[model samples]
Target: MSDRYAPDVQEERRAAIVAGLVTAAVGFTSSFAVVLAGLDAVGASASQAASGLLILCVTQGLGTILLALRYRVPVTLAWSTPGAALLATTGMVDGGWPAAVGAFLVVGLLVVATAAIKQLADLVRAIPTSIAQAMLAGVLVPLCLAPVTATAERPLLLAPVVLTWLLLAALAPRWASPAALVVALTLAVLAGDDRSGAVWPGLAWTMPTFSIGAVVGLAVPLYLVTMAAQNVPGAAVLTSFGYRPPWRAAMLVTGVGTIGGAPAGGHAINLAAISAALSASPEAGPDPSKRWVAAVTTGTTYVVIAPLAALLTAVVVAAPPGLVAAAAGLALLTTLAGSLRAALTAADRAEPAIVTFLVAASGISVWGIGAAFWALVAGVIAHLVLRRTVRAR
Candidate 1:
């Protein structure tokens, strides 16, 4: 009986390792371009962006490892992809890259506060789901359109990337964005300019400088998006797998990770939502008790790959103007669709949602604040006014 059981145990260990590697691969490859693009848009130099990516990977990986080991559960963490998309749309704020770093620090503090203060978490929860989703949908619209716009701009170069994405999406949906990115990266290399001096893992740090505009425009929206889109969904995913993650501990870990990585150029880090399933699900192993192994493997994989951030950043920097955007756009398509569906799901709240969506997509800024902050402002007001009118009626 012991000998017979040994084979099963070995198989489970193998499956756990495979699942972990796949989880890390899918998570990193799919949205890394979006992160790089976001950092660049917010004025991160190449080295700074690479440093940001590297630190994000290291911190989230370390956080996941610590959490999974401590709780004996499969827990995973990731950079806030939607928050990255928000940065891509927000562009450069009043104080530029240092200011953006400052905003990142503020977001980290806010996450810590949410964990510590019930009222703060409640306040985040109180933001109407429809409005939040709408704002996210609106922010995603422009970034998601990159592929379409790139097609017209450089038809020959972008055509293959889009085709690969569409084909893989239909057949192996999980690999779609990653495959598309691979194609784009290859094209970038073939069409490469002199990248002779590019560093293997170029790293840089920027001292954070805070301003009111960055705090309101970048930090506030980033915190909201990270919480609403990543942290909440991640908890739900883990719960669905019968794992009761230590919520406060996870928050504190991620918040501290975010704060530590901020000056190094990382935007934000949080619980992994989509990728969490890769490690926590039955796919990791038949026995739920053993799934934590997969999480450890996943975390280890991320740390191992973190060093490649500079190489990837160099490739993107050397690529054509629209190429990286096209890949990033492909990566975000599903997220955009989901956000849109959620935003408009309820008939009663459709009006406010729409208002939020339009304002965010409008790309407007007032008094140095970006559209995302104002979209929330517009949405809450619309929701309240409409509610009062209905009561009066």
Candidate 2:
């Protein structure tokens, strides 16, 4: 009798399941857009890009699982959706995929090395949570805005999808999210976004290359952007959820994944921000105590989904852009809203957050890294100097 039944344990397990499923649904939309756009940056043929995205999703899902299991904490893993956005507009301006892959390896190594020393984590922690939250908001604000921009073109195809998402998001919170994804994709495909069912990309493997240009232009910026805009917030998210995972573990996994997938147009791997939050939220795990289980569940789902790299790639190619855009925007609203709320809360830090938000939104560039890094650097300096002057007074 003592060994047979455990109701409390079962309730905890049920909560974990809820967390994993919701996050996975949200991740599909957010992650896919970045993957699709990044492929365009790398000059990947449609098939190759799709496969790369699939590989990325699967890997991150797996990473979320393995880490959560090892730590018995809600240590979630996700692709750098913003990092992919950083790569999308300008990556093609570089040496195409080859140079981009070279840049990817360098950044991956940097993340790994960051884990090797405690200094980086200390530095990250030194920044106020308010500032970190601001950076995160800056990164994700685009997700909410992109859909509006998309509607400027394909309203007919996307309006229905968007409306459907809204209806579901409001009425049936549990099944609505994932169900919206499926319906939106179906509608998009019906609208002829599916470019025929010839769903196979020519697979290729690329070894890492060296690029002094990429080092300063791409790698360093990626490191800064990803660390500030993604990983730092990611760590904070975990902490907010009552778990303390080793930062090294997160960095090491990203570094490894980055290097391994660069040849395939896998640009960056970092702690997921929005999707991870959704997955690890109270919605995902009703019982806060079972959050780890939710993370583990996310990982298990990833493992199941990762291996059919080719098939997964094909599906992305077949999906319509309008559909992807609308769904992604709708799916990620809560994420964007939360990040914005956090950014504006710290009165003293408001100026810096505004600067960061502006720079990132401007999509300007310093070298090759895009606006995300500069926004962080700019905000941090502004925040520090302002604080210093105040203290001096």
Clashes of each: 0, 2
Over the stretch 286-381, how does candidate 1's per-residue lDDT look in tens digits? 999999999999999999999999898899998888997899899999999989988888666689999999999999999999999999999999
Candidate 1: pairs in clash = none
Clashes of 1: 0
lDDT of each: 0.93, 0.67
Show model 1 residue runs off by greater than 4 Å. Answer: 195-197, 200-202
Candidate 2, after superposition: displacement of residue 115 in Å? Answer: 1.6
Relative to the true structure, candidate 2 reaches a TM of: 0.80
Candidate 2 regions with alpha-carbon error over 4 angstroms: 1-22, 89-93, 126-143, 172-180, 193-197, 201-203, 210-213, 272-293, 307-321, 347-349, 366-369, 388-393
